[model samples]
Target: RVKETATHKAGAYATVTVPAGSTATYTVTVSSGGTSATGSGSYTAGTTINIYAGSRSGYTFTGWTSSDVTITNASSKNASFTMPAKNVTVTANWSYSSGGGGSSTNATLSDTKVEFDKNEVDDLKVTLKSGSYNLRSIKNGSYTLREGKDYTISGKTVTIKASYLDSLKEGKHSLTFDMSGGTDPVLTIIVSDTTKTDPQEEKPSVEDPVNFEDVKSSDWFYDAVNYIYKAGLMVGTSDTTFSPYTDTIRGMIVAILHRLEGSPKADIANGFTDVGSDKYYTKAVAWASENRIVSGYGNDIFGAEDSITREQLAAILMNYAQYKGYDVSMRADLSKFADGESISPWAKDAISWANAEGLIQGSGSQLMPTGNAQRSQVAAILQRFIETITK
Candidate 1:
């Protein structure tokens, strides 16, 4: 039996080394001056050490602590102590396990400390901008933005620098910036085409024929009917009859004008009481009346749905010609027409103007001044109107 030592004084000290990949167990005995106390410990090679002090019947055991040492096992069982990589001070403490049993032992372990080195940075700021537009602002870190992949702020320009971007794929790209903050203006960039054509003209499609059996076969009305139908400017009643000979109403004429000039600008005046804002032809009629293209019958009442006469159609064509900036004031006299008196006082000047512009011509020697204007006549007038505008 090994002689027991006193707990009040240093008990027994021993140092043992186990080979790598192996383990060993040892017994540490505590003595209370003359009495011996029991304890056991186990250690593994390579990186760890376990110290255990066996239970003493009247006394309890406390664990170990060091700056570098980590306790792997619970502190409740045997007091386990882990050895540090470098030499340092450590402590193992204990007191009485029973109410008045009393206790003692162990001070700091000596020489255990370690050292190492590395690099770090502080206070870094990153910004992104494009052509007077600021994108993002970042601070306090190393910012590694890709050339083209990462965009940045530089003064007024949100620059997508060329370094990381592919030159082959380089072209103007439109960027829409959210300007809600009022800090930057929204920007759009077009890379390739600067001019875009009208969508309607881009794809040319054939026009549908205005279904008038008699006039569809007529050479004079063919171009007019085709042009209006193709542009979706006109459509026949049903699939068969255009009712070309039926007189066009004043409202219908206005509808045609609304379609023809692609619905030109119009303003409503306070004088017209019958014209309501919600009416379908209100704007069209207002435009025609204001521009002197069409007017009322009597007492300022525009007969909007009344059939239009040849003289009325002539006046409309003349006003349209004048609106197109054509000079047509000389051809007022229809001396060859037998019923020249039948021409309305309000229509004479416009009729003369249309005749002077060569937009209106008599069938043979007849001026047809009082004749009701047909749908074919209206189509012819529209065709001439289109030609005038194109020129």
Candidate 2:
């Protein structure tokens, strides 16, 4: 409290009062595998407060948990939120990957069946067994559910979004869970209606046709490019040109794989001297490096801008498959290719695995291991990779 005194010429006094502003407190914590940035502090309401989760070696950051506060990117290791009028606590979740000196185990989710009213907005949770696993996809007959938009997973709980439930028809539907480990679980969802109502026909959604001038319908990579574009994995260099012949850079490939994982946040700086700090591929490169997807040139260099060769792409993709806990034991007899003997020793296993998986095919009698890969070739390889795993 403060007090003021004033005297005028006629010995009269007037007083003005002022009050101190209020502030909100914020606290951040990490469950494991990382450390939170020093975000515990008091700030004025509506102030933008930054939070960070610095991941330790061998641990992967999952997501953030905050009840009342709305984080800008809850899944990012580095995120921000506005300070509310009251105190808030944010916790970051992290997990250990197999490569991080952790033993692997076969895990599965418990099959669950639930019935609810069509107007109900409660989320459904599925129990996950003890193990580190990733949700590959959710399938309902021929329809696939999109993560984040349709559902979200945190730790052992898989929450079926209320919006997704409300969108379903009043009938029994089975959602098959495609997990990375053990047996896949099935979720039986039965939406019921309390009152009789006429069934409304859902309008079919029309997909825009791919119209890249450089990618003609007769081109060998036409379907691959179309798949890549539709999957939201790649885009054209221009509005009308796919630039199919352009050389794909190392950074671009890393960025594509990052997108395939929904672009999980990696706030830590990747120790690549060649990779720029503010480039568009910075976060993607960091995430890839942390996941052991790409190991660049020695001496702390990633060569993000350099064009990636066939062998390099194979090696990177192989590492990625292994990280995803996919079966990468398949090997092809490279002796069939004439120049197979010329393939680099370090990438031999990767090249063999890629060939066996039909992700990379040779032309005529040459494997072209050292040749720089074109955008079209990469698109084809990625399409084949996706098909092989989804099956």
Candidate 3:
């Protein structure tokens, strides 16, 4: 039996017996086109449970919904709601992104401090993305530093000159950069005094994504690095460095591809003396070898550390496409390129397959097939590869 208590009555109260809690089950399921994730909950009725919507690379979570109307509020991709009256199963829907770049209008660098002495001819770099040029101004209460005369901008990297530092007195300094296409930077440069002996390194109160010494926003592959890193496909050699210009190894590419394929089981034995199951790249090598995506150098040896050429990347990616049942047809004329004949015999078909799909644009007039790809170049190509497959 239930009883109505107070209806907007002040100081009025009524005693009643609350119903016992019932166990409710919730399950999360995806139809397709999403990284597989597990979501299950068993909670008492009327309890609030949070449902987090997750997505894979190149995909976005739409929302969550269930058939039963008993479950109210079918909105919010990541939200909490009351337990339904009965068993409920929620479906996660996903949609692909257009794979384009987005720049911030008000993006600003986090506040930071630096220690430098006068007469020290050195460079102090600050992280920035491509967009705005022409520094508006630099102010620090009593003094200011001019852009072209005091500092220089190279891509997304900002280098403050020692000539400017020599002019400033020792103390805390705050500078505001007025950027056009990019976000303004809110950085603090600490001019170390001539007094004392050693100066401690300045640290950020919180970690910033753009703090990588080598990765500035102005670089062409900046967005791609963030995309791939966040998607769990790649990582930096260190927290402070991405080494975007470093040459990538063949084994590394195989491992990245395997991760993109959801790290499937290694159905076939990978016959490579150089790569053992104990190594981290072992599973990736196995998957690549089983699917004919890549083969070792020769004599049961996989040159895991050898530099991977541009043509090799093309071939492996093409093989991956075919393995995934994607069409690898070609209709483009490769003979038009000046260095077409330089392509290796075995890699011709793969290169042709990729080029016809508008995936591999030649370097100037040359195909540069044998040339190795830089880390930055790999990120750009990988981004395009995912975009192409999704389309």
Candidate 4:
């Protein structure tokens, strides 16, 4: 026999008991035009879970619907809901659009999973598809990440700091990036044990190798130097030394670009008196001047021996991109950099475009627009330009 007392009153509080060991399963499905939806898992009752919707090619994400639970922000590509005591499923809707969405666009992350060695200090770089978007928030479960402290943004790339990754325990973790104008992406981070040896490091491959004594495999610009060297875009100062730290001269830069252009003969002579006809860079200067890729310093003289500044290099590359009919419309907001105001007015657009395209990654919080670019730095910039822009 059971005895209980019940009172019926307005605004009365009632307590409900969920059975021990009970779990709720969350599942997500998509409509005909949709591809896949994330955020399906088993969780305890009353746990809030994030759901992100994805659309197939030639389709755009519309909205979401749930028959059993109330979804928060159903119209957004990323949404959330509290898990009920019973199993529930959410459905993502999509529509077809044949026309291209121009500047107003949706973006996707380049990768869904990333790995980090506990002892390594390399930041986790996550790239996004071509679009203009702002990051709203980054969440690891219920915890919110603070920018600059946890991560930094450059163009469409989000770099999670190594300090933050090192703090995480050695295991798998998930982070959700909520951004505007696109699907909010989730990243799975696998933190590896520092004590364990990586077998790949035992015998490194030497294909298309650069045997410069100064350029080590551990250097940050190693691959870039190797790439430019093997491609015949740049060569070492000596057979033994690459002089990676040496400042690059204007003539050298033009010569490299001329080599990239197949070293075509100039139809007319360049009007610069300083560039001699017998010099190695004379044809390059002539070709560059004829193509309008560069304009020598104001007084009918090309300072061929002068060290090229960061802004000048950016402008030259921008001019080259324009000549090649590549898109130069994308521009990044340079206000984040401390020295943004220092960029020359003439090179403003070029620097902005280069920053947005990841061609000129500035020193921490400083663009250093007036600083001279070094040989290794130029090699890295050329590598980025070729891999991203030309490809």
Candidate 5:
């Protein structure tokens, strides 16, 4: 018999390796203070074996197994026995420590799971199909949009709830999506009114002499003249010459406005010494000053005879739009016009807004904004204004 010695205080483990083709029974013994206990396992050659503590005064056994075995003398004071043919290696592990308490050797396992639910109604989408031009004009009732309706997204098989749908005039509109606190992409959609007539192509009727013979008789001025005329905003001179090529003067323009407003009589004393009470445009000039439409040229002199320029016309139109409760600020962009820097400071915003909103187009790339505004240009401006409000 081969002999090996293993010493453990209590609650410990001892491992023993036996040689192949070895047969024997092995025993493990533990002692603490004066108490002791023993356990044994039997195995044949070519097998491994292990022995564990059975019972003792103050001890336990953990993780011990037997596959090969050996026998040894079990009658010695703290003496360990071993088998020579097994040539086994034995290891003793102690659990009882000097100060730290004991702990379990079992391991813990962990796992996680994920789940999802399918939704029936996925999204809602909205689009502006038309009326982009009128919508931007800041004019009321000229353009309308559909309201309080529902639409669906077809390709994705998703149901959309549209609280409102607006009927805008024919044009390109943008589509947008609302995704429950998430970002929704945008798409462009076209809305059209196939039945609408082309106002530009409509000829001036020969029977309506008062409407057709004005300086705005040509088709180019038709829309502008009609709109201003229908609104009672502008009128022609006594000679019936709309004077499409003639330059508009400051005093004449004011008189036209006074007439458009029903020629409201002025009670205040004339502020300009140069304008006499008997002058043809006296009432109009005085009223214009009172209404903040026209200011003096300099030193209280109202240059009523000077021709109005393109820039000046733009300023007046924009101001009129504002007075009518339209917000022209959105179109403000002075830099777009080459002559923007030359415009009067007071008229800058109004002119820029008019140009940007397509209400007034520049003469070529350069705006020639400071140049005299002829009757034809004025007619065009008026036509665009009328079309905007009517649409």
Candidate 6:
């Protein structure tokens, strides 16, 4: 409390009052992405506050935000900071899961069913659309084909052992490919008589179309696959296979984007602890990260090898486009999709822009926003994104 006294000349005196106690207080408000036990609070000047974020299934907490001060642990679930002398607003952040975002499959075999005409010196070789396609098991009836003993697998080629081939009966037999994490259709093998001796037809030279033996020119993603390969933004799983149905990992996509940027020298520090210095994508990750084109999971982990989803890719591309001076504003409404709500809140704007710009399409009425992205889809989207920007 304060009091003031005034004297007018020597005879008259007046009393006055003055306000006191002017300590500043601040309000701390939390935002979206996850729920907080304490939504908001009030604190006196220079008061320290501890804030922790809750975890959501299939989402990772990327930290908090405040207008007044830099968040101490922006990427961790638990964080704390001192309150400033003004109203402070902080928000929770999360990244979507890329492991299971879509229903799309991987590149399949050109000949889902293979036939053997000769067995004496000929090996039953199967070619996959993607060299990296996972082969869980090959089953003939109840007997599983031993990987090294019965056959050998390398890159896109799967070879049947000469010993196994010789022991096979000369009747119609079937082999089934059991694999995971791909959209590849069912592939089968038929072993017929192996005595016919005839010269095989000439193979297509490398100068031919980008079509691998497995990818027909008539396939939906043929053009997109070819465009990316020719543009050097992407390539086949091997010299001849594109693995169109293969899941594209976070690291691989960033590398592709980096290439599209003409492999510019970013000279940015590698902030992610997961990306090793000896990794092929280390420089690319550093560049994309430095340019604000990509983000890692909380705790400084990028999950580089983890599969990325369509919406995730959309968000990433949106960031890259904006960095390149492209307009990524919300031009399209996404309420039409059945799973529109499945789109992560942080990715809503980017997905909206991609959808509005016609850079990405949905499955009938479903956007499958949380589904994993296939390599073929990446190629197609990358082509569309590049065209949109260049045009």
Instruction: Find the candidate with the highest lDDT and give its number.
Output: 4
lDDT of 2 by residue, 129-236 (tens): 646666688877545676786679887788887766765656676887877775677878887767555544121111465899888878899888988888888999
- For 337-391, candidate 1 gives per-residue lDDT tens digits of 6666667888788677666655567687676777777777777776665655333
Q: Which residue pairs in candidate 3 have backbone atoms (N, alpha carbon, C) closer than 3 angstroms, thus clashing?
A: 128-217, 129-217, 132-181, 132-182
Predict model 1's lDDT versus the native.
Answer: 0.51
Best by TM-score: 2
**How well is each residue in 1-391 modelled by candidate 4, as lDDT tens digits?**
2222222122222232334555453333323324345565455576566666755665577888889889999999878777677767777776545333433455568899999997777899998663445578887754456577678888878898887776565667788888765677789999885666677543323366978999999999998898888788999999988999999999999999999878988778878999988988999999999778889997888899999999999999988776554557789999999999999999999999999999998989999999999999999999898777765
**lDDT tens per residue, model 5, 1-391:** 3433333334443454455444464333322322333323333343323333343322333323223333332222232444434434333323432133344222111211111111222233333222111111112222112122234434333232321112233344343332222233333434333444577544333334454465444466655555555555555655455556778887766776676456777656669878888987899887767656667776989877889887777776665554333445556566766776888887677677777777778866677778898766776676665456224
RMSD of each: 33.9, 18.2, 21.2, 22.4, 30.8, 27.0
User: In candidate 4, which residue ranges exceed 4 Å CA deviation?
Assistant: 1-206
> Total backbone clashes of model 3?
4
Give candidate 1 regions above 4 Å deviation: 1-215, 218-220, 269-279, 330-333
Candidate with better TM-score, 1 vs 6: 6
Candidates, ranked, lDDT: 4, 2, 6, 3, 1, 5
Which residues of candidate 3, in runs, are more than 4 Å off? Answer: 1-210
After superposition, the stretches of candidate 5 with alpha carbons farther than 4 Å from their true spots are 1-219, 226-240, 386-391
lDDT score for candidate 2 against the true structure: 0.76
Tell me how far the alpha carbon of residue 3 in candidate 1 is from the true structure, in angstroms, after superposition.
99
Question: Candidate 5's C-alpha lDDT?
Answer: 0.50
Estimate the lDDT of model 6.
0.70
Q: How do all models score by TM-score?
A: 0.43, 0.50, 0.46, 0.48, 0.42, 0.48
Instruction: For each candidate in the order shown, give its overall lDDT on alpha carbons.
Output: 0.51, 0.76, 0.66, 0.78, 0.50, 0.70
